[model samples]
Every structure is written in C-alpha cells, then in structure tokens.
Target: MVFSWRKKKPRSFNGDKKKELEIPRHFLCPITLDLMKDPVTLSSGITYDRESIEKWLDDGNFTCPVSNQVLRSFDQIPNHSLRKMIQDWCVENRSYGVERIPTPRIPVSSAEVSEVLFSIMDSTRRLDQCACLDSLHKLKKWGLESERNKRCMVANAAAAGAIAAAFDAFAGESVDKNINVLEEILFVINWMFPLTEQAQLYIGSQASLHCIALFLKSEDLSLKQNAITVLAELLSCNQKYTQALTTIDGINKTLFHFINKPICPSITKPSLTLIYDIVSLSNENTTTEFINMGLIPLLLEIMIDSQKAICEKALALIDQLCETEQGRGFAYDDALAMPVLVKKILRVSELATEYSVSAIWKLSKGDEKALMEALQFGAFQKLLLLIQVGCNDKTKEKATELLKLLNPYRPGLECIDSLDFKNIKRSF
Candidate 1:
C-alpha cells in the first residue's frame, strides 16, 4: 500500500457535469466572505460588498474588517468595473445556475435633491408645482433604492428642511390645488424617520399640523393614515404640540370616524395608535374632548374588533381614560367594558394584562357595583392565575391588592391560601 507523493495523478471530473465552480477571491466580500454583487470601496481603501460595509458601519463599527485601520470617512464609492466583471463571470457560468446581478441605479446627489426642493418652493403656480412633484417623486424613488441612498438623503440638511418647508407651503394652499403635493410630502417624511428636531418643529408648527388635520378630512384613506402617523410622530417629538393638535376643529371627531368605519386594516392600526398617544398625555381638556366625542364606546367596539398590538394599545388608552371620573363613570356603566376588560388578563400580552388589571382596579375602588361586576365575571380566577404565572413585580402587586379587595366577597376563593395572604400582607 506504499505510495510515492510525486507519482500521484490529478483527479478528473469523469463527465460529472455538475462539478463545483471556483469563485475568484477578489470577487468575494472581505466581511462576509461571499461574492460581492455590488463592490464598493471604502475611505480606508478597502473594498466590500456595499450592503456588508454599510451594515458594519451602521452597527457602530469604525475600523476596516481586514486591516483594523480606522475608517477615515464613510463615503462608499462604487467599484463599477469590479461589479461588471462579477456580472460577466456570472453570465459565463450560467451552466452552474449563477444569476447575473442587476446594475444598481446611482444614488441622488445632494445637489439634485436641492434642485428639486428649490423648484418645489420657488413657485406657487399649479402647473409648476405638478412638474416639481414629478421630480421629487423620482428623487424619492431613488432614495427607496437602498439604505445608502436614504443615508445620502438624510445627510443633506437642506433637503430635509426643504421637505418640511414644502409641507408648510402646501398647507397654506387650497386642498384642490395641492393635495397631491401634500401626499408626496407625507410620503417623504414617513421615509425620513428620526428627523432632526428642527424639521420636527417645522412639521409640528401650526400650519403643518393644520394640513395634517385637514388631510384627516379627505376621502383618501391612504392620506388619512399617513396624516395620523405623522401626527403621532409629532406628538412624540414634543408634548407642547399636543395642545395645538387638540385645538384643531374636528380632529377628535375625524379620528373616531376612522375608528368606526376603517377603510383598511393598515389605516385602522395607526389611527388607534395615534389615539393611544394622544390620550396617554392625560391632558384634562384633551381627555374631556375625547370623552365628549364618545371615545369610550368606540374604544369598546375597537377592543372587540382588534387583538394583538392594537388591542394592547386600546387597553392602554382605556387605562388612561379610566383615571378621570367622567371616563371611569362611562366605562363602569358600559355592559361590555367590564367583561372585555376581565377577559384580557392572561389572554393578551403581559402589557395588555397589566393595563386591563389596572383599569379594573381603578374602577373597583369605592365602587361596589364595579367590584361586584368584576367578581361575577370571574376576575378572581384571572387575577389568581396571573400571580401563579409570572408577571412583572408591579403587575403582581396590583393583582395581589385586587385579590385582597375581592377576598372578603369570596371566602371560598381557592387560589389565595394562607401563604399568599401572608405574602400580600407582608408586601405592604
């Protein structure tokens, strides 16, 4: 069995047509060790697949993966020649089931973004506005091409500010004249999240808020959804802007309209989320406005209709509403509210359970009917089950207290033994 090393023969394919093909080392991304579909050169003179390098940088990496050198800058110049070579190689290896990578479109430059923005604001004429909107649409389409392009769009302060200003400009225009432009503006803002505070201020300004409020009135479901989302973002950015939103004529009523007859699931979700954000602020006047607009009954219907995150949000909002005497009175009196609230515990998410229990606890205080209703609805079973299964400490405490409150009413309730009662007594 002895063999000489120098006498070994090279292996043959032996007519095996599906033999593995070799890929050029240069065509592989250094980071991923895979073929580079879109080779891009970094400022450190290292090459990587565009996605690989962008992800590395986006995850807070500042050094080259191979050299460990600090990246001087983040500009990623496309290696077109290498990309074309990879494409040709893929075409040459079509028998191996290799697919050619499509050419990537060039990202829009800051100058181009500025030009379109200038065109948009430099004129008030409808025809000119329409043309500018077309240009802006093309730019947006480019930005949608890749995260690289989105970063380019965000880096340009002028472009971001111009977009916010465009909203203000269109806000003042007659809806018949500028609704299309307004829609595009909302689209752009939605794409550009984490907007600069300055831009947020501009969007939250009186005029911009007015435009969004007006958008809610439109028959366009998509527009109304976008408006609600943008409005929600604006509220989160600055609490001061909430007063302006509440002051808008028919804003609360418009929100309820979407809640009642949702055009689509997408529209309904965000509308409910926006309501959650608004009511969570706990502004007396705003809350009163919501109550006056019949928010309680609408919320109950929405709860019956939705589950998952939307239901969680509905429950959270209800928790806030129940803090007020008026809201509590409305909810407690509703035949559907108590049972629905009780059923949510141990049923939805832990957060939903907490919200439901809190609302029930609020209603139960100094209200014999509320306490009686909860026990009659098997609240004791759900509360005991919540404690036996793990929940957050605050939630467990609330459940414990509610159990204690209801214990005198049900002496034979099985879950609360001597140890449980002792633990609850000691926690105080």
Candidate 2:
C-alpha cells in the first residue's frame, strides 16, 4: 500500500523503450537514407516512402513524440549530412578489414558497346572542349582497352573511329576546324606505327594503306599533302626517322611484295601510283633503300603495264632521280634507265613514242651519250610514229618540236626530217 504512494516509480520500461520513443521531422530509409523503399513519386518529382518515415521517427527525426504525422515530405532531409556519416562509416569499416569492393564487371551488349564508342567519338570531336591534348589522346587508349587489349581489335576500332571522325569533321567546312582533332588521331596512329605489322594484318594491307591515305584526300589538299610531304621532309632532315623508314619491315614488304605479284589490269594502275610516291620522296637514303629493294624492276613492270597517268607519274619520278647527282651515280651500272625507255617505246610504240621523245629531250639536257643511245634505239622512228598517231594537234606540234630539237645538227636534221615527218602520219 505504501508502494502506491511512491507512484510505483512510473513502472520503468527500460532504456530501450526510451530510445525507441524519440521521433524526427523527416524520415529516411536505413539503407538509402535520402528516401524510403517503394517511394510514391509525385508529379512534382518528389518521393515518399513509409520505411523512411518509420526510421525517422525511431531515430528522433521527428520533433513531436506523440504525433505520428510529424514527418512532412515538403521538409528537406539532411541528405548531405547523412551521406557524409555513411561515408565515414564505410571508411571506418574498411579500416577495420572490410575490404573495399571493386566495381562489378558490366556485361556490355554489342549494341551497347557500339553506342558507347559512338558517344566517345562524339566527345572526341569536341577536342577543344577538353582541357589538354592528353585528354583527346586518351580516347584511343580507352577504346583500345574496351576492345580487350587485342591488337587487331584495337587497330580495327581505331581505324574505324579515326575515319568516321575525319569524315564528320570534313563534311561541310572548308576551314577544317577539326584539324587539331585529326592531328591527335594521327598521333595515336603514329603510336601504333611500331605495331603496324599487327595492324596491317588485322585490317588487310589495302585497307590499312587506304586509311593512311585518307589524309591525302582531305578537303584541304595542302594540309593533306603537307602531312605526307612533312614525313618525307622529316626523313630528309632527321636521319633517325629516315632510318626508321628504311628499317620498317612492314613498308619494305608492302613495297617489295607488289613486284612479284602478277600485274592484273585492275591492280596495275594503283600499284604503280603507290610506287611513284614511295620513290619520289626527298629522303635520299630511303630512296636508295627502295632502289636496293629492287624497285627498278617494279617500275619497269609498271611502265610496261600501267595506264598513262600511272606511267607519267612513274616516269616523272624516274626523270627526277635521273637528273640528280645521286641518281646518276646510282644509274651508272644499272641499265634500268635505258632499257625501260626502250621497252616503253617498243610496247605502246605510239603513246610511249612521245614519252621516249620527251625522255630523249631530258637525257640530252645532260648526257649526250644517253641522247645518242636513245636516238640509235630507233628513237626517230618512235617519234615519227607519235606524229602519225593523229593525236591532239598539240601533241603533233610537240612531236615536230622534239624532232627539230633532236636534229639540231645538220646531218641529224636531214636524217630525221628526210624520213618525211608529215607523210609518216598516213603510213601509220
């Protein structure tokens, strides 16, 4: 009876009941604190979850202890503070031997992979937006890694990405705003240069070269041509890159392998064009290396089998070398110059006759013996046939002009004109 006077000590429910009695203004989920599970998202883009309300009340997030509606959705939650607390807890747990988890491996579908690559290329286009050239440079590396670090995969992806980027950049503008991007792409390609053997095989020789040659077809032809010309110029200046060119096993194989392949009509022209450019560079050592790699035979084969443009380009390159001091030294023992000229004259007989006449004109500029040898090889007959072909009137005039030049001396003059150059037209 006296216990009743003590008020029964309020029948204490232990500290657990006191701890559970607290409430809060806004509740958060125990797992994801900003909102509760199964949130009711509103038209205003707000979310509410019952579990978050319960946790907030249990954790004293609500101010009213007896009122269950103390939580309000309009009231902002302490998301930032809660996030920091959780992060600190994670750090502490990690320190206590809870190993940090790695990102789960994403199983990317092929389509997703393609979309990601497209997005990357799109971002790469905004090269100026990037903080540094290194940012743009890393794109290729990322793409390569996505392709599983396999060289073929990397090269194929890079080639495709580079080509697409170049096309998009050059599509409409003449100023080439994307030149910097293109240069970065080329820089990446140059990094792969040492690995060109794998690339060439992966993309095939023709496709590989075609991709490289895309720079040549840029709308800015000067820029395009300059890219190629600079490399030659560099090889001319720096013996190191030139030596690299000389020792490039891939290029050597590409240049030399074409020789033994049968000269089909379809391939004849391009093969010759490639050879022309390869030989025309200013690098004497590289040129010499090409020559020593048996380029003369290839040139001869092209001269005999190629189209007019191919032949002209090839002959001009040869003419350039034949006029050089180094060229003459190289040609001293090699019958490449004379025999090629003779064979061309005999083959096309009419078309080549003009080239032969021009060749003699060029040879006469320096080596009289070369001129005489050209003439003795029925050069006069070929020249007359050129006039007889009934070609453009300008070509006929050129033939007449060459005839006059060859016979500057009276005896030679009479011998050539005595053949009745004008009447020779009807005989053919």
Candidate 3:
C-alpha cells in the first residue's frame, strides 16, 4: 500500500528545470507510507516501522494488514537485516534528500535491568550520590524511549525498591545538595507508574513515606507533581498505603497550594486527582484535614472559574466533603456554595450532577433556609428535568429525595410537569 513520492521539475539556479527523484517504494512503511526508520517484523511476517506497527497493536488491532490473518502475538521482532539495508540505502541517497536513520537503542534484558538496579543501590549506599543519580537518569531515558524498555524496567523487582532506598539516603543527609537528584528520581518513578505489589509495599514503607512527604514541599513543579502522582498510585495499592498517606502532616495544605496558586495545567490535573483519591479513601483524619484547611471555599472558587475537568473534580471533592457534618457546615457557610451547587446540577457532566445533587440533599435536610434557597435557584425544575431525562440511579434517587424534602414548600407538581424543556440541554 506504499506510494512513491512523485518527481517534479523545478527551476535550477541557472534557470534550467531539473527533476527530483522519488523515494524508493521498498524503503517506505506499508502502514505510514514513509521511510521505515526503525523497521520491525510482526508475527504476520510483514515489516513495518516499529512505531507505526506498535501503535496499531496498542490500539487493539490483531490482524495482518496485507494478508488479513489474525496475528499470533503482538510481539514485534526487530527486522535488523532490513533496518541495516534501509540505513545503507539512506546513506547512499543522502544527495536525494534522504536522512540517515539513527540506530535504535536495543531494549534492555531482564538481567541488565537487575544489574542497573543493583548498581544504583550500591552507589547510593556508598554515598556516591552522583553516580547513583546518573544511572537513574539513564534508566529513565531508556524507559521513555520505548514501551519494551518500560516493561523490562517494571519487571525488575529491584528497580522501584532501589529508587525508594535512594530517596531515603538523600532525605537522611545533613545537606540539601542532593535534593535535586531526589527530584530527578521522583520524576523517574512517576514515569514507571503502577508499581508491582511488592514494590509498592516496599516504597510505601514508613521511611520511604516520610521521604516523599518531604518531597511535597519541593519548589520544583515537576518534582511536586510527580510526588503527588506517586502518592495517588500508592493510595490505590491498598488500605495500608492509604492510611500511610493520611498520616502525613500538611499533605492536604500542600495539595491545595497547587489549586490556589495556579501552576501549569499539568500540575493542576494531578493535584486534583490526588485530592479526589484521598477523599475517596474516606479516612476520617484526612477528611477532617481537607475540611479544616478551608478547602470548601477554595473548591467553590475553582469550580466557578475552572475548566470542565477541574470543575467536575472540585464538585466531586465538595460532594465527598459534604458527607461529614463538618464538611456540610463548611460548605453551607460559604457564600457561593448553594448557588454554585444548584448551577452545576444540570450544567456539568453526569458525575457532577450526582455529586452536586448529593451535596444539596445533605445540606437541605431539615435546613429550611437551604431547602428554600435551592428551590429559589431553579433546583426544583432542574431536579424534575434530571429525573425526566436520565442520570445514574444514585443521582436520580438523590434528586427525587431532595424533591420530596421540598414538597411541603412547593406550590404543586402540575407546574413542574407542564414546564417546557425543549431548549434545555441536560449534561447527563
């Protein structure tokens, strides 16, 4: 399916036309129709660019492109011979505008990965911090280069454990000179997400936990973001990790700083994600920390001014916070809380509706002013619309329950049923 580039005649410097030759057909990838820089052969016995074919397989495609046969495996065998030929061809055709393909770094073997891990560990213990950081940086580069290397690195049990040990070493030091190196180590760990169960257990240990807690204060945005991302992953590992994170002092304040100060969008996203994960864990002290930190007002501000994703996450945190009496009281005390809650009911996504409705339900029960305020803010119509259209069962139930709470204060259902909603677009 590859097509050759067409030659075109253009005026030369002397005012005479010259023809440009087309790229060779076999030199191009069948999938991309571009020169195959890193050629690889799949089980289908066809050669294609490694990146193009890997993308195809990554998207869940399993059949051969030309033969239409199911591939035996997604494993790609490097077409070393074909790649050498392509390199030779590109070198010979340099005058024709062909760029020589750089040699692809070979994926590391399991033994090589273990060797690197042990080397890093030994260097760190010997206080050769410079060498340890250099080895980690190299491993990080390899992991970023290809999915093959990433898998190999993760399979080596010592990889994550060694990184955690190095963090402990640096954090325990009397000087701050190696803190930047720790930041680089954190960045590498973030790249290798979802560590193995054993690795997670090791990294989530008390010493490593304390080390990462210190990283939360790092002035480097990348380091701080990576630290939070790793914490979120650790929280997902099990209850022990969640409990461990909950005990870290000032964790909630550190996370909220990103939201309030407004760093780059990359930092904001993970900061919010970590907040959601902490709240979702439902740890009592963690919830109290979030509430006592004046997070409700800040969350309301973010929900009001942020994009769709941040808005949804802000609302979700508000929802979880409302589950506690302290959270409910804090939210109710906020000037913008009720208006923002009712406005988000039908305006944001389904999850937002569910969370907002649940928050309103918690606030409106037996609170005459809050219930009346909800109805005054067009919540009655919005609730009926939510039930009329469609949302999750929990959302519908909360909406229905809130409606019942407002029943005594309502005029009648006839007006609600007769109202026109043709122009209203329900987010759910």
Indicate whether candidate 1 or candidate 2 has the larger TM-score. Answer: 1
The 0-to-1 C-alpha lDDT of every candidate, in the order given, reads 0.77, 0.45, 0.77
User: Model 1, poorest ten-residue lDDT window?
Assistant: 419-428
Q: RMSD in angstroms, all models?
A: 7.5, 27.2, 5.4
| Number of the candidate with higher lDDT, 2 or 3 | 3
Tens-place lDDT per residue, model 3, 1-428, is 43222232221121122656555677677776777888888788888888787777767878876566799887778988988998997787676666789999776778888888888888888878789877888788888888878877877766777777676677666326776677778887875667767658666776667777787777776677787778877776665676667677777787788788878777777777778777877567778877777888988988876788888878888888888888988987888998889888875688788888988999998898888778767788888879998999878888898989887777642233233345677555
lDDT of 3 at 271: 77
Structural RMSD, model 1: 7.5
In model 1, pairs of residues that clash are none
Worst 10 residues of 2 by lDDT: 4-13
Instruction: State TM-scores per candidate.
Output: 0.81, 0.37, 0.80
Model 1 over residues 73-189: C-alpha lDDT tens digits? 888899999999999988987777677889977767778767776776665334356775886787679777877777777777766666777777777666567778878888877
Model 2 misplacement above 4 A:
1-162, 166-253, 260-268, 305-313, 329-336, 339-356, 384-405, 408-428
